[model samples]
Target: MKLRIFHQTVYRYDRPARNLVQSLRLTPSVSEGQRTHDWQIDVQGGIRGPGFRDGAGDWIEGWTVRGPTEEVTVTVTGRIETRDTAGVLRGHRELINPLAYLRDTPATKPDQALRDLALTAKDAADPLGLAHRLSAVVSDAIAYMPGQTGFHTTAAEALEKGEGVCQDHAHALIALARLHDLPARYASGYLHTTADGDAHEAAHAWAEINVPGLGWVGFDPANRCCPDERYVRLGSGLDASDAAPIRGIAAGHGIETMDVAVSVEEVERFQTQSQSQTQS
Candidate 1:
C-alpha cells in the first residue's frame, strides 16, 4: 500500500509567548515493512536543529520558535510505501536492550486487576502465543470509545473503566505484557482508515512486545490485530508521553491551547511533488 499523511498542529495562546522549543519524533521508522519518501516537517517561524537516531532507533529532531507571538504551527507531509510484515519489526537498527523496556512507567504500571488479566494468558505455549493472547484479552476488556478517556488515563484506570480509545488499549496491553515478563513499549504512528470503516483516530497508538527470536512485534488491541500495510510506524517509548510525535514547552505565563489534525489515506495513484527543508 502507498500511504500519504498530512498532519498539522496549531498552538494558540491567549497572551504572547516566547522561546517555544519542541522535540519532534515525527519521522517514520525504517524497517522492512515501510519505506518513506519525500518526507518533510515544517514549523512556522521556527529554527531547525540537528537530528539524530536514538537508542530505540527513532529519529529525533529539535526545533525552536523564538516567539513573542500568540501562535505557532507545525506541519508534516510524507509518503510511505508499506507492506504487511506480520507486525514483526525486522531490519531495524537499535542499541537499546529489550530488557530495558521491561521497566515500568506510570502509564503502563499494572495494578492488581491488570496482574489478574495477565495471569489469564499465562497458559499460552510460547512468547508469541502469549503476546497474541494478551492482545485479545485487552481488546475484550476495553470497548473502543473515543471520549471516555484522556491523555492522562493509566492502564489500570482504563482496565477498571472497561472503555477507552486506542491510547488506553495500548497502555493496558503494555501493562499486561510487562506483568508476564515481556518487554513492552508504546508505539506512536498513523493509521489509514476508509470512511466506510469504523471510526478510528488517524493518529494512532499501539504496543510493541519484544519477543525472543522475533525482535519487536506490534499489537494493536484497539483494532484487534497486528499492524499491517495500513499502519505507519513512527516511534516507540516507555509510554505515550515519551513517544509523542511532538513535545515542547514555551516561555511565558500565557495560557496555551492546541488543535491537531491528521489524515492518513491510501493513494490509488502516485504523484511526485518537490519538497525542500526550511528553517526560520
Candidate 2:
C-alpha cells in the first residue's frame, strides 16, 4: 500500500528576541517492508542547515535563528509505499538496537508496579498475544484525557493517575516491557484516521517490542492494536523525550504556545501497466 503524508508544526511566541535552536526528526524511514519517495522539509523564518543521522539512525536537522524572531513553522511532506509483512519488520535495520532499548533513560525508570506488570505479561509464550493482552490492559486501565501530565511525567505517575495521552501510554508499556528484559522502544509517528471519525489532533506514539524470531512489532496501547499500514514509523528512542518530533530552545521566556497538525491519507493504487500504456 502507498501513502502520502503532510505534517505541519507551528510555534508562536508572545515576544521575540535573541537566539533559537531546534532539532528536527521529521523524516520517515524505509525498511524492508517500506519504501520512501520524494520526502522534503521546508522551514519558514529560519535557514536550512545540515542534517545528520543520529544514533537512532533518524535524520536530524539543526536550525538556528538569531535575534528577533517571532514565529517558526516547519513543514514536512512525503510519500511512502509500504507492504504489510504481518507486522514483522525483518532484519536489524532499525537504528535503535533491541538489546539497548532498555539501557536506562531518566524518564522511563520503572518502579515495582511496572516491574510486576511486566512479569505478569511475560508469562505468555506468544509474545504477540502477550502484547495484545498488555495493550488491552493499558487501554482499559488508563483514561484517555489531556492536561493530566506533561512531557516530564513519568510512567509511575501516569499509572498512579490512571489517565494520560499517547505518550503516557507508550511510556508505561515501555517500562513494563523493559522490566521483563524484553527489548522495547518508544515510537513516535502519525496514525491515519479511519472513515468512522475525524483526524487526530497531534502526532501519535506507541511501543515496539522485539520478539525473538518475529523482530520488532509495534503495540499501540493507546489504540489497542498493532501498527498496520495506517501507521507511519518515524523516530524512536527509549522514551518520549528522545523521540519527540520537535525539540528546541528559545532565549526569551513568557509563555510559549505550540500547535501541531498532521494529515495521513491512503492513496489510490493504479496499475503500472495503465501508466505505461498511457505513455505509449
lDDT of 1 by residue, 17-54 (tens): 99999999999999999999779999999999999999
**Position 157, candidate 2: lDDT:** 87
How many pairs of residues collide in each model?
0, 0
Candidate 2: tens digits of C-alpha lDDT, residues 80-147: 88766665655435454679886767677887777666666666768667766677777776777888
TM-score of every candidate relative to the true structure: 0.95, 0.86
Please list the residue runs of candidate 1 whose C-alpha ends up more than 4 Å from where it truly belongs after superposition. Answer: 269-280
Task: Go through the candidates in order and give each one's C-alpha lDDT.
Answer: 0.93, 0.77
lDDT of 2: 0.77
Best by TM-score: 1
Query: Residue 203 in model 2: shift from native, Å?
Result: 1.8
The top-ranked prediction according to lDDT is 1
For each of the candidates, the C-alpha root-mean-square deviation to the true structure, in angstroms, is 5.1, 4.5
- Model 1 clash pairs? none
